[model samples]
Target: MIDIQYSAEVRAAKNDGTPIVALESTIITHGMPYPQNIEVAAQVEQDIRDAGAVPATIAVIDGRLRVGLEPDQLKDLGQAQGVAKISRADMAACIASGGTGATTVAATMIAAHFAGIEVFATGGIGGVHRGAETSFDISADLHELAQTPVTVVAAGAKAILDLAKTLEVLETLGVPVIAHGQDEFPAFWSAKSPFATPLRMDTAEQIAKAHATRRALGLPGGQLVANPIPLADQIPSEELDPIIASAQQDAEAHRITGKAVTPYLLQRIYERTEGRSLIANIALVRNNARLAAGIAKALKAQAG
Candidate 1:
């Protein structure tokens, strides 16, 4: 078995049987520049704690899988340069090669499962990118959710993705996409999208029960809780629609493909929105963290 390092807090939570929520580290290393990334990470962790669960931010450091990061480690990672943004395909290679890396949603799910964590919180998941018919770009996150039995809470797939296609692909994969408290599927920065949700769940307890029921039935996959961003923080989808289109055009014009596509589009959106996108991102992540914590607690209660 591969060795996993646990931060002192996580070690304590494990020993005490406290509910824990897993977090991805790419948001720290790849989401934004230093200091601010660390600050947002700290805030999200605190939100989980305030909502009555511990947070385990997963990443790979110097080839070792770290299930939870200490304060110093988080700070260093935020400042580190050229860290690999790893997913299912590259995570193992990063570890085996003794390289430091930040985990994406898929990689975080794998690590969370290895560490026996059942819930995760993130801003938004990558999904069917626009123009994927030609690019064949689909996120490994969708596939991970189809097999890994951890509950993931997010606003929804990133707004830049083709939301309808993302939902269709999830249905095909047999993954449950449960929209929290609404009939409409949420856009990443906006509370509602044009598409209706495949499933709607109102309470964390209901979501937790669904998760347990899936496990009881020997289901091989996990559930996605589409928690919407708070109304005050949202950037209306109507406003973002045109911005996204423009960004995509820029991407096509610049020939930004594959992994570069997301960051480039996000930067363009960020520039166009004058930083409102980042603010909304931070808000939604914290909101997801709170809800994920509640689900973790509910699951713990169900187990007992």
Candidate 2:
């Protein structure tokens, strides 16, 4: 079995059976610049803590699958150059090759489950990219959600994706896409999208019960809690529509495809919105962290 290195805080939490929420590391390494990346990472972790749960920020550091990072490690990772943005496909290779890598949504879910964590918080998930009919650019996150059995809390799929198609694929996969406290599926930076959710749970307790119920029934997958960004913090769908279209046009013009598509489109959107998209992203992520912490607590209570 592969040896997992848990941070001192996470180790203690595990020993005491404290509820823990897993966080992905790509946001630190690839989401923004040095100090700010670290700052936001720390803030999200603290958010989990304030909500009565521990945070396990998973990453591969020098070939080790670290379940949680030390503050120093977090700082170094934030400033580290060329840290590979890894997912299910490349995570093992990076570890085997003794490389440093940041975990994306799929990889984080895999790691979280392996580390016995049932909940994870992230800003957004990748999904059916636009033009998937031809480019066939679907994300591994959907498949991971179908098999990993770790609950993921996100604002929703990133706004740049084809929201309707993403939901359709999740439905086809038999993954429960439960929107938290709302009927409409959230759109990352925006609180509501055009698509309605297939499922909606009003409280973390309800969501947690569903999670446990799935496990008891021998289900093979996790749940997606589409936690909406607070209305005051959201960018609003109407305002983002034209900006998203312009960004997509730019992406096509630049021929950005495959894994490069998301970052490129996000950068374009950031530029167009004068960084407000990023501000909303940070807000939504922290909100998700808080909500995931609640779910973790509820799950833990159920287990007890």
Candidate 3:
């Protein structure tokens, strides 16, 4: 009934019981410009393959849920205009209407679970907005993690979000926020945040075991693997804080509200930072892909 279609590689991987990592499509359709978006997406997919797992970039094309995209499909998605940012709430509607859309973190997790994939790689997860208490503008991604059963690997919540509130919400939802190889939680473009992670994991095997243990204990939700951006590529918290503040102010000045806020802020930051933020974003995404692949491989090995 889901009407899901898989790429040849994804289908083969599924049939063979091989490791496969789920990737969200927003990074292509909404995160960056065309050509570069497609190129970076392809590179991330290739990173998973190089690490011994298949990549399934989830999206809805013409109302059908696609587990993996072909090269042409990826290109089209990158170039398409006015693509809907589909989350759990809108994914079904998009499919029902036969619409073309890109999956966000929440939608990607749902699709991955439906496809029996356990690990997802992304640049970062959405979280509590800076003024969420008053605006009630929290992302559905938080609640999605509370119920979904897929492990998510990312640099961390976007720097533009209220990291403290995001971590608090995750804690309340009983989701494990495991920082990979560090005690401090990452802040997307920055390698570290001021807050400490609830849990720390040193290796992919440990993170994989934590995921398996959660399932064994009948835990209701997935785990957040907060892998930090490589130190070399990081912009540092001190440098990014002021830049983020300026971008946030710009968004408020422009009256950008709701979903428009994130893209507006990111675009402003990208310009303010002279494209360094985008470079760091692409690097972190590749880093996440590599880690997710390892975690997927470990999960498969454990199953066997």
Candidate 4:
């Protein structure tokens, strides 16, 4: 049997068949500091509620795969140290070992699906790294998208990654990359990238309909809804290009590779940008949460 627990509110929602949007725990554990992380998490949850959906923040704690966390649990998680960054490869092991860990995009999708939740909100999905051709360090997020049936709403793949190659891999895997209200795919902090999106969707209802249609046709995997950050919050790609290059160079100089490379580069960029990147990250995540809530609501309505 699966050792999955739902928070009181999530349990009620499940019993009542209300729309519930799944949130990832890594944003609280690994993405930011304590008070800010808790504050942002609560805000995101409230945003989902405001849009008429319940927020189920997924995580694993002491051998239990929690579909949603209580307020105190969120705070405890935010303050915990050395929490495992779980993905498809280690999620079950982490749960089986009674470990406390945060779920990444890939792991979150898996947990959300297990809980019968179909929509997820996240800041960005991981993808091919810059030196993936040599390192072959592609993210499990790609494969998760190709197999999981959860619709992930995000700004897009992190800009620090090889966006072109990431999109190519998603395409080859037959994962639909749908840009929300735009032709160009979003670059985590920015509204547009050089590459075009494979699909364009302008509304939550339309995106939800597409997801339903795919399932109706017996298609495997989920849809990636690449919502753009608000233009006012975006740092133009032109300005970020050089900063990204410099950060990547520093990572290479220090030989940062594998999972370490992303966090290293992100921190370096955050420092180099004087904390602007973090602000942009928060804004994009909130934006994605709002959109994900809308999609979840639409999906629920469609089901009825």
Candidate 5:
């Protein structure tokens, strides 16, 4: 096993068999600006704790793949300049080289599984990018889901991506795409999308049972629990679609490609929306965190 330093809260939680939810660190390093990023991350962690589960916010720093971060560590990471947004490919390399980086969904799953944490909450998983038909810019998150057995709770693929093709590729990879309480798949900041998902489970218990059943059947990979952002917090698709199109056009015109595409699009959307998108994003992440806590508790009960 890789050596990892556990934060006091996570250490105690493990000692007492408390249910723990994993959180990705890229939301701090790449999702938002300094103080706001730290504030948002704390809120999401508190949401899990309020729901009676511990939050293990994963990140790599100073050569350690830490399962949970100390407050000082979180603060420094929040303000650090140019931290590599670590994913499956470079996660190990980052650790080996003693480099600091924030974990993305794919990297978080790799770390969570190593830490023996089964459930994770994130704002949204990356998917096939727009124009992926020609660019073929599918995200590593999809392939990670097909191989890792960690249950991920997210609002869904970000609306900025090619949701149809993302869903199609997920189907091809044999990952379970289960919508929560709704028949329609969620569209990140919005509560629903026109696209249909493969399955829907209305309760956390049901999602937990399905997770256990998959393990029983020796299935590989995890389930994507598509939890929608609360309607009150959502930016309606009708209002946001044109803005998204405009952002994409700007990105294309500016020649932003590959790893740069997502951050570029998100920054543009934030500017265009005048920061409402970030607020909605924080809401969805906290929402996912609460649901993940419930599912983590259920999984513990099932195991016991």
Candidate 6:
């Protein structure tokens, strides 16, 4: 049997058949500083609640996989240091060893599926890193999307990555990447990218229908709803391009590779953007949470 933990709020929601959105805890543990991490996480959860869905923030604590978190748990997690960044590779080991860890996009999708939640909200998905052609460094997130049966809502692949390559990998893996409310795929902090979305969806009902249709057809994977961040909150692609390039250059100069690359690049970008990147990240996550709630509601209603 698989071990799982549920918060009081999540347990109640399950009992009542309420719509719920699965949230990743890495944003709290690895994405930012404590107070801001907890604060932004709380705001995202509340945003989902206000949009008519319960938020289930997933993490692994003391050898058990937790599908939701209490307020105190969230705070403690934010303050915890050296938390393992759990993904497809290490999530099981983290749980079996009684280790506490934060869930990345891939781990969150796996946990969400285990919890029977159909939608997950996050700031962005990871993808092919720059120079991946030589480094072959691709994120497990693309593969998780290829197999997990939960819909993911995000601004898009992280701008620090090679977005075009990321989209190509997703396509080749038989994953559906649908841009929400636009033809162009989103570029994390930016609302627009040069590449067009592989698919476009305008409403929660339509997205829900697509998800259900895939399952009905005996498909094995889920959909990626590439929700663009709100226009007013976006940093714009033009403004972000040079920043991303400089960060990548810095990573290369520092010989950063593997897991350390993302954090290093993001931190560089953060400093270069004068802290505006974090602001945009918070805004986009809240937006994705709201859209994910709507999709969850539609999925529940459709099932009913």
Tens-place lDDT per residue, model 3, 1-304, is: 8878999999999999989999999999988877899999999999999999999999999999999999999999999998999998899999999899899999999999999999999999999999988998888999999999999999999999999999999999998999999999999999999999989999999999999999999988899999999999999999989999999988888899988898899999999899999999999999999999999999989888
lDDT by residue for model 4 over 120-213, one digit each (tens)? Answer: 9999999998888999989999999999999999999999999999999999999999999999999998899999998999999999999999
Residue 48 of model 3 has an lDDT of: 98
Cα deviation of 135 in candidate 3 (Å)? Answer: 0.3
Better of 3 and 6 by lDDT: 3
Report the CA-based lDDT of candidate 5 relative to the real structure: 0.94
Worst 10 residues of 4 by lDDT: 255-264
**Angstrom error at residue 6, model 4:** 0.2
- Regions of candidate 5 where Cα sits further than 4 Å from its true position: none
Q: Provide TM-scores for the models.
A: 0.99, 0.99, 0.99, 0.99, 0.98, 0.99
TM-score of 5: 0.98
Error of 5 at 163 (Å): 0.3
Candidate 1: segments with Cα more than 4 A from true spot: none
Residues 130-191, candidate 6, lDDT per residue (tens digit)? 88989899999999999999999999999988999999999999999999999999999999
Least accurate 10 contiguous residues by lDDT in model 5: 27-36
Q: Between 1 and 4, whose lDDT is larger? A: 1
Clashes of each: 0, 0, 1, 0, 0, 1
Residue by residue across 1-304, what tens digits does model 5's lDDT show?
Answer: 4688999999999999999999999999888888989999998889999999999999999878999998999999999997998999999899999999999999999999998899999999999998988998999999999999999999999999999999999999999999999999999989999999999999999999999999999999999999999999999999999999999999889999998888898999999999999899999999999999999999999889
Displacement of residue 57 (Cα, Å) in model 4 is 0.4
